[model samples]
Target: MAELNGSPVSLEDLQTLALTNYGHFTSMRVDDGVIRGLSLHMERLVRDSRLVFGAELDPEKVLGYVRQAVAHQSGSFNIRITVFDPALEMGHPGVEAHPQVLVTSRPTGAMPPPPLKAKTFSFSRDLAVVKHMGLFGQLHLRRKAQLAGYDDAIFVESDGRVSEGGTWNLGFVDEAGTVVWPDAPVLPGVTMQLLQQAHEQTTTAPVTLADLPRMRAAFATNTSIGVRSISKIDAVEFDSDDPVLDTLRKAYAGLPDERL
Candidate 1:
């Protein structure tokens, strides 16, 4: 279920969001009342709030709202926190910003599927940095990929430079067995950041669709799926059991969890 602030989501809330849809959000996995990289999640909210809303977000208040929304929850849950101003008008430029925090929680499985088959789409998000509510383009590409019998979509620029996946960050294992991330603009997922910190060999490099053929292997990362190997992208097939992916899985699992 979803709650805006501490109350259940109402039709009025939906209507308000539909008007402008000017918001940013973050999602994470809460396991046994603990979460990995909780601080990073909060930091993302605060940072994005400033960038998108031109206002500061109170991390403590956001945390309180999250705790209250998930108070009765247990076991593993996927939680999302959305920040938006209720009074925001569609095109009004003088509206006072009073950001509201919406928290949603749902039960989740223990792990992501073993691997995924993805296809490349020559599309990218409007503002690639912020995790805003604007997802029409990305979602469209994902739907198209799924309809084509692919697990997901990998977004690439017109020049074939891979930016990220539809919802997750893309990581490639180079021929030298190094975890290389696309240097292009991305949402900078919290899990991806944590993985970089946990693994010293991880580095940022510009990976394009043309380079996939030469890549040793590839993987996708997000809060929902910690690290999922990619079996295929377009006509190129990858090994799911690559040693580099195994190391990445271990690195993500070794990170410390924080109390909610």
Candidate 2:
């Protein structure tokens, strides 16, 4: 982990910290030539920053800086550039925001094995917006899961439908073999949207814990790992021998070249 634009972040953490009081940033994977929905994600970043500072937005400069950072990387690169607020101090809310930008890059860690390929988010004040500092919501969601004796939490809709994990999208393989994931009312994850649109390999549906019995296996998709297989849910574990997981992993792993 290194400080990008002075925002403390892990090399393994999702590459979103660049959006904080730290000016603007960009993240891209070089291994497979995958940029991780560069255009869409950048749009969200600029939109988030504009709303945060009431300033005119231009992500092109930020992206050009990010490309330069990527040039410093050796292999698959996860790069970020953050701008810290020069005008305001940390932990003081409602203060006028003047952010300074920093940029950094690093290789990603070993991906979470199987069904866990997805962005992981913790509950945070930055939930709605992608700001740099929000330790509360980040730790709160993780701790709640630990207290409940589960590996993690799958944020649910008020009506009881499964929405997303703190950082990843929810996906369950139905008894009939259809892979299901939620469509809207949540941040549109890069991997989730792409794989979900692949129809033959995946499909969309509102999922809930009550429907777990119908799930033979489950998985999640994200930019970090591509796609990971989930063996357990809320204490219930499933087959490690599932072949579908391997197939999906290979499918996505092959995507880098496919895109080129």
Candidate 3:
């Protein structure tokens, strides 16, 4: 069940959210009551809430709400927290004093598919930094790629530089065995941040469509998937058994978990 500010969501609540679904959100895998990089998750809420809603979000209040939502749940769960104002208007009159906090939890596996296949698409989001609610463009591109027989879509800039995946960040294992992230405008995902902290060789550099042919292997990172190998991007294929990918995965799994 979904909870709106520590209470069960009612029909009136759904109607209010449907009216104006403008907000920023974060999703993470919660094990029991602990989460890896819990501080980063709270930091994201504070930063995104200020940017999207023009108000500061008290981290303690958000955590209290999350704790309440997962109080009776057991095992791993996919938890999402949304920050928005129910009475928000479309134009200038929509500004609200305090944004509403909504938390929802549902049972889920530990990780997504091991390796993913992606197709390249020419698209970018409006605000690349904030993980906002509206994502029609990227979802549409992903659907189109799925219809064309690909697993998902990877977004590329007009200049041919690869940015990120539809709902994940891309990490490439170069020929030298270094984990290289594409130097482009994209949302810095929580999983990507954790991996970077785990491995010192993680670095950011320009990765273009032309550079894909030279990379030894690739992987995708996000809260839902963790670190997953990228089998193919369009016609180019990568080695799923690459040792570098395995090393990075082990490093990610070793990180300590924080309690809610």
Candidate 4:
């Protein structure tokens, strides 16, 4: 995150930073408060920490650290908790803090995409079963996609099948008006799981970019944007203007404050 160009970063600073500033994060959108997927995100942090550091890190300890660090403030934002060998992973020598624990948050901006969602690779770069500090390529790809005039990009593995987008899962209307998602091993995203189970329109299968033109509409699913439609990809416009997208948005959009 330090290389994010003027992005203020601190080691173990989950308390100071909002989740938006951090990639590979878990933000709650369906419910209230900062860090949308607090419980699930915390669970992943503990699980990933142990896998990478071989240290049985406690979620409570991490939470306490965050509370102590940002104890004076209160606000909802995105959250990223990192536990890895900052030295070995980055190949930085003489760094005293190798296996460090870092947590940070960033304020969420306007909620534009709705009903349709995307998951950049950074958020799901590790084994679907493990949430480790790995997915660096995702951060790079998202920026690249935007420069090319796209809001997000879906990940397609070597087999050329679709995965998720930036931080959301991809769902689309096929030529037949059938809604589908190509792959499943998506990291345990709270929003993804909720909608997949709740909605009858959602389905999982192997989709390819070759299938793009046949799509009548496309949207990404996640907690942050809820269900957001996509306006364009590779400058080729897709229909993010479907009524289903709005239906899903009303069913799951809004900030925590609105709920209370």
Instruction: Tell me each candidate's TM-score.
Output: 0.96, 0.71, 0.96, 0.67
Worst 10-residue lDDT window for candidate 4 reads 15-24
Model 2: residues with Cα > 4 Å off, grouped in runs: 1-28, 32-34, 81-84, 88-100, 112-135, 144-150, 199-201, 240-243, 256-260
lDDT of 4 by residue, 202-260 (tens): 67777776777777888776655666787655434687777766655654543233221
Query: Model 3 off-target regions past 4 Å?
Result: 92-94
Tens-place lDDT per residue, model 1, 49-160, is 8888788989998898888988888898899999998778887846668889999887777665689999898886877989999988888888999999998999888776
- Score each candidate by Cα lDDT: 0.88, 0.57, 0.86, 0.55
How accurate locally is residue 224 in candidate 2, as Cα lDDT from 0 to 100?
Answer: 68
Which candidate's lDDT is highest? 1
Task: Order the candidate numbers by lDDT, best to worst.
Answer: 1, 3, 2, 4
Question: Model 2: what TM-score?
Answer: 0.71
Worst 10 residues of 3 by lDDT: 89-98
Local lDDT at 63 for model 1: 90
Best first by TM-score, ranked: 1, 3, 2, 4
Q: Which residues of candidate 1, in runs, are more than 4 Å off? A: none
